[model samples]
Target: MALFSFYNVRKPRQYNHTPIYWDPRKEALEERIRKNKRELGMEEPLEDYKPQIKGTFVEGTSHLKRSYNRGEDTRARKYKTFKFLLWLVVLGVIFWILFFK
Candidate 1:
C-alpha cells in the first residue's frame, strides 16, 4: 500500500463572476445632495432639524441620569442573579452529599 502521494498534476479553476449590488437609499441620498448643491444659497437649513443619535450615551437633561440609573439597576440585578445561582449550586451539592453519599 502507498503511504502518500508526492505530486499532483491538476490546476485549480479561475472564477471572475462576482455580482454587483444597487442601493436605493444611497442613490436617493446622492440625488438629494446634487439637488442641494444646485440650489445653493437659495434655502437655509432648518433650525429645528437635529441629527438623531441612538442609545443611552448622550448629554443633557434627566435622560443621561436615567440611563446611568438603568445601568446600575441592571448591574445590581445581574449580581443578585449570579449570587442566587451560586447558592442554588452549593445547596444542590450539599444535598447530594448528605442524602446520596
Candidate 2:
C-alpha cells in the first residue's frame, strides 16, 4: 500500500521517423487534369494556369439598399413636423397662463 502518491504518469516515447503529409483531393484533381490533357492531345504544362475571372453581380446581406431621392427623407420630415407642433402647443399654454390669468 503506497501513501501520498499520485496515479502512474509516464513520458511518451519520441519517434525517429519524419511525418509524411499528403492531400488526397489535390492529388485526384491533378490526376484528373492530367487525364483530360492526355485525352485532348495537349502537352503537359509546366507553368501555373490562371483561369479567366467572370464577375457576377449578386445581392448579399452586406450590401446596402439604394435610395433615388437625396433631399427628401420621409421619416425625418415627419419627425420635424411633429416636434414643431409639440413646441407650439407647449408655448401657447405658457402664454395663456402668464397673460390671461
> Which candidate has the top score in TM-score?
1
Per-residue lDDT over 26-94 for candidate 1, one digit per residue giving the tens place of the 0 to 100 score: 999988986696568445455324444443344455755665657755677679789999999999999
- Looking at model 2, residue 49 earns an lDDT score of 36
Q: Which candidate has the top score in lDDT?
A: 1
TM-score of each: 0.35, 0.30
**What's the distance in Å from true for residue 19, model 1?**
7.8
Q: Give the alpha-carbon lDDT of every model.
A: 0.71, 0.65
Off by over 4 Å in 2: 1-72
lDDT of 2 by residue, 1-99 (tens): 765456775669998886598888999999998988976869545443333222122122222112113343557667878999999999999999999
Q: Model 2 — TM-score against the truth?
A: 0.30
RMSD of 2: 17.4
